[model samples]
Target: MKPERARSLQWLLVRRLILLQAGMLLFFIVLLIVVLSVVKPRLMIDNEAAVTAVTGAVDRDKDGKLIVHDTDELTQFRAEHPKVWYIIHDTTGQTARVGMAPPDYDRDLGSLLSSVDHASIGFAGKRDGKEMRPEAFVQKVDTKAGPVQVVTSTFHSRSDSEGFDISITAIVDMARKPDGTADWPRVLPGLLASLGIVLLPIILAMGVTTLVTTPAVVRRSLTGLIGTANQAAHIDFDTRAMQLPVKNVPQEVVPLVNAFNQALSRLAQGIDSHNRFLTDAAHELRTPIAILRTRAELLTDEPETLRLRQDIERLSHLAQQLLDHQSLDRPNEHRRVVDLAEFAGRVAADLAPLAIEAGYDFAFEPPDGKVEVEVNALQIEQLLANIVRNAIEHGGGKGTITVLVDRAGGLEVHDEGPGIPVEEHKNVFEPFYRVHPHSHGAGLGLNLARQIAQLHGGSIAILNGPWQGARVRVHLPLHRQTA
Candidate 1:
């Protein structure tokens, strides 16, 4: 399957991280709004308290009415809280007195103050087990002096059976212009500035955190995936006990890993069954063929008896090739370093007499130095025997068969016979595949040789030789150090 690079596991992790940061940013915005809402009420309470403290500090008579005296404390209080104006009024709606008012303080402040209702401003009750309290009456009024914003509150002190009112006027210029127009210009920029100052840092901090952690977290999560890939790459069909590890693997890929292991198990079982069938069948056929060969030899040295003996021997060789092919499938338990040049020379010497009897010349060319390789010695011997035997049986003429070895553990068999066609070269290594239908040999020889070569981490290829012959070259890894 082609990988979607943009949608990899790390991409998904980074996307999720960004989404989480976005959610946090949204939460921060909500919290900021909540804080601003909560703080608004506290600011109103502070305004009310400042007004009340200044209003209550005025000199008072025994009857709790204002004594109409201005002290240094009152002047300082008025200077510190410029937004407040004081008013003394009788409950009977008479003209009121003002002290420390702004020059543009509306002359109509008295009429606007008299219109206030104390009972309407005292909003308090218990409803549904919840208490509600109202702080102050804050309002804007157009006065003859100009326009003014006022927070009207009454401060009352108690005497026996009598009450007096000091109707205080706390102007709220922070909410308006001198014309009492709504002062959104002053408030909106400050509100937005505060929100930006709070939100930008939070966003930058979260983005950096996501960038730093997403790759590490994604890599940590894929550790099991990398391990599973390595296991699949190195799986050997000869062994059935190996399996991918489940511990510490991610839950998302657990099922895939389990499925791969199950597939490996099934494949190993099938190969085992095939190898067993071949070995058993070859063992079963060998005895009958051996008896036939013995019976033909016992008959006379006539041409008919000699031909029959050769046929039986060919059958015996085919049976042995089947056994050799089956042996290649078994896991190699003993692989030791052996001299490749000497091994090839010995096998070639053993097969040279057979080639001589077949009206051919067989030669062994050994390398000057030892060519050592790590392999199962029995399988390597079988591989050399099969290649030499193929050349002797099907060279198409009484030509020379030469076995050459090199220092790199490479072996080459060159025969002065018609080379294989290029189209059939690859197919020649398949079991039971033959180039010539009338050839007096089963085609398992080359196939068995190929299997053994592969088992030893080597490869074999058939090509046209330098002479008018076919060359089978086997390239095996050389063992630099003896084991």
Candidate 2:
């Protein structure tokens, strides 16, 4: 069984699913930003500003050829964009010059410029079927400064001499920021604004829908099984008529439930057969036992005939005890307010003659007023009679046997013979457990009495008596009337 504080499976699954979906969405959002920044470096690069800065720093040489001279303006421009690198090639003079560039940038820029020149298109029309306009685009590339955005604008400058043209190309470098952390405040609002109006509501709706319906769905799925178990709990096996409903029950549980019903059916059949056998056997033997007793009475009034009569009576009493034990197994037929003190006096009166004939003294001490209790009268009578009989038999048939009813609705039968041995106190209440094997009485009397006491929601206990005797106490509840 799970602990009380543990979460159920349905909620655990729903929480995990929602988190997984949200994580995937956030992952893709970061991935898309990285991809866009790399493909179009201008998204993070300010190319127009760098180009104007570079052109303003350019000057004319002695031959009137455009030359990029070292100036404070170029130094300040380099200070502002520390990662920017650039190169300008003069095809007319067959001269090349580098601008405010890193040492690693100077080495790799030549090959890069060569590639840019071949692919670059000038302002002039097609030459050898190739467009001559300058190649102007933005891209991200790896350099000594790490992955930086590069915006290159390539174009031809108009010259005074024919065929003497200068090619100007400017390169600016801006390092790419780490994913998810770069300009997040600015990017997040735009990104969320595009999706927030719709996507957030969609996700929330899905999560709320799952949370609201998950418990109900789980309860609905188990409803049939729960109903079947409750019905089984209240079923009385004696009726043996009810079966668990298979319809609407989960298929996986159907086989086990049906098997349980079948077991109960088999049990009911067995109990019915056993009871029928006990009833038939008791009926068959009762007539012969009565006939024997009558025949013994008809014989001459001698010791042998009297002994025979006593034996028949013992046998008859044993049969009755057996039947009484059997009745305790069935549900009681009626319930009423029984005056326990009056009831104990009546049972003691009926058994007093037997005690006297067996050389024992029998007495009853009932309370002055009625001590009423709600119980089945027949079962209560049987309980009292068995306790009295046990006292008479165990008292060696020569000592005082007393039945007392307390105002608390407790009935106690005690004997002034050899009290039951302390070791045998618990065992003596078990069926067929005799403290003395030679005793003529069947050992089922105490067990039957205990069962009857329990049926009425009471208890019976064997305790040491007040004065050198064993005491059997039956404690039951009393019924009271309100004014």
List TM-scores for all candidates, in order: 0.63, 0.55
Q: How does candidate 2 fare on TM-score?
A: 0.55
Q: What lDDT does each candidate get?
A: 0.70, 0.70
Candidate 1: list runs displaced more than 4 Å: 1-7, 16-62, 66-213, 236-241, 298-308, 463-465, 481-483
Assess candidate 1 and give its lDDT.
0.70
C-alpha lDDT of residue 68 in model 1 = 37
User: In angstroms, how far off is 161's CA in candidate 1?
Assistant: 44
Off by over 4 Å in 2: 1-250, 480-483
Return the clash pairs for model 2, or none: 121-132, 121-133, 121-134, 122-132, 122-133
Please list the Cα RMSD from the true structure of every candidate, rounded to 1 decimal place.
12.7, 17.1
